[model samples]
Target: LSLSGFINIYLQKTFVSKQLSNLLINGVQPPPLPSKKKVVVDFSSPNIAKEMHVGHLRSTIIGDSMCRLFEFLGYEVLRLNHVGDWGTQFGMLIAHLQDMFPDYLTVSPPIGDLQAFYKFQKIYDCLDIKLIERGESYYQDQMVEVVKEFEKKGLVELDEGRKVVFPPGQPIPLTVVKSDGGYTYDTSDLAAIRQRIFEEKADIIIYVTDSGQSTHFQVVFAAVQLIGWYDPKVIRVEHAGFGVVLGEDK
Candidate 1:
């Protein structure tokens, strides 16, 4: 046979080898990691007292799948439900709740419809208020403190009465604090990351969200890395972004 013919025969044999079939059928599971590495799969972080929308469903499904995969792979998977239990929105919610029920602290109010109650306590609020939550109150001060410390290091700066970080080569600067001096999503995320790394000892941290927030996560990740909180060598951080789940045009 010609050289080319012989090469073709060899390739065919290699592809259809009995060993290959066995490997494929048996599924060669990779050996476990050297040590039980701590991994935090931060996903499905829906805020408390809010209706879970399609977005929340997406995160929950995908995050659960990842957790299963990691667990099977022999890593110490921490299925972190990074619940959105913090921020200015919660402040508004509490204040409104207090106005509605002054004894809310001492007495547990009967909530008939969460969505309705959350949407319009007395007057109709924003349209998006239907899925509001009240979870991150404790992190309020912590987030502010974290941003202020970053500001002292020259990483975060005040643009217009708001503390922010304009990352190198990035267009939109991450707003840690707003003009009202209220802590934003950026500040809470930083505080969470700091705690995850230092306290939780998360060697590998992953955030699963839709592609829309890609820039937001990127900016926050960069900010933390710049401030020396995240060192690539010691720990790994990634944003597992997915595309949108659009409805078909009927």
Candidate 2:
């Protein structure tokens, strides 16, 4: 057979125009993933009482992009906005509010009007991004259980009156409970990760934050692995970190 004969046979078998029309209409199909996995992406974590800055914007956009990609790839994606709505700072704010407004219980406080003024949800709405707000306060009640579990597994130790856990090969110890019997970021993160794995049934968990928090998430993931919560080989955990956005002056 000659080149002309091979070309004639190929043209007869394949419909070139039809294939092009299909490509244009339906677009390209991406390869199937290994399995239908659930992905939980935590991002756009702006703190309470603070304005949303460039860092939060970057994280939100990046995380939403990843969620869209995963959804396109046939994965169940859960977009989470882990806001900083708990801590000692809130206690101080509450105390100040109470002091300023003595009859706060009987009458509506003036500050109540501003509650919706600086909400991060407004920004999400403007961007047309969907996210569930599960802040640190959501895991406040569960922190005690996390500490109990850590104590049960002998993963926690009393270091200078603070309950801390030292991940394997880590130089710094994670302070889960402070000396004042208050839960820290480590405790809430541990609780959140466990909830995402056990309750939410997430096969992959991705946290989008600034690069400065890379070590924090690393330590949290390591501690979770040490607790035997989830097998690293089975579940995928990642921290998608971005660089800091500096001001013009800096």
lDDT tens per residue, model 2, 99-140 = 989898998688645565566567888888999988898988
Q: What is the C-alpha lDDT of each candidate?
A: 0.73, 0.87
Candidate 2, run of 10 with poorest lDDT? 4-13
Q: TM-score, each model?
A: 0.74, 0.88
Candidate 1: deviation at residue 181, Å? 1.6
Model 2 ranges off by over 4 Å? 1-19, 112-119, 248-250
Give me the candidate number with maximum TM-score.
2
**So what's the TM-score on candidate 1?**
0.74
- Candidate 1 lDDT (Cα, 0 to 1): 0.73
Q: What lDDT does candidate 2 reach at residue 233? A: 95
List CA RMSD, all candidates.
Answer: 7.6, 4.8
Model 2: per-residue Cα lDDT at residue 211: 93
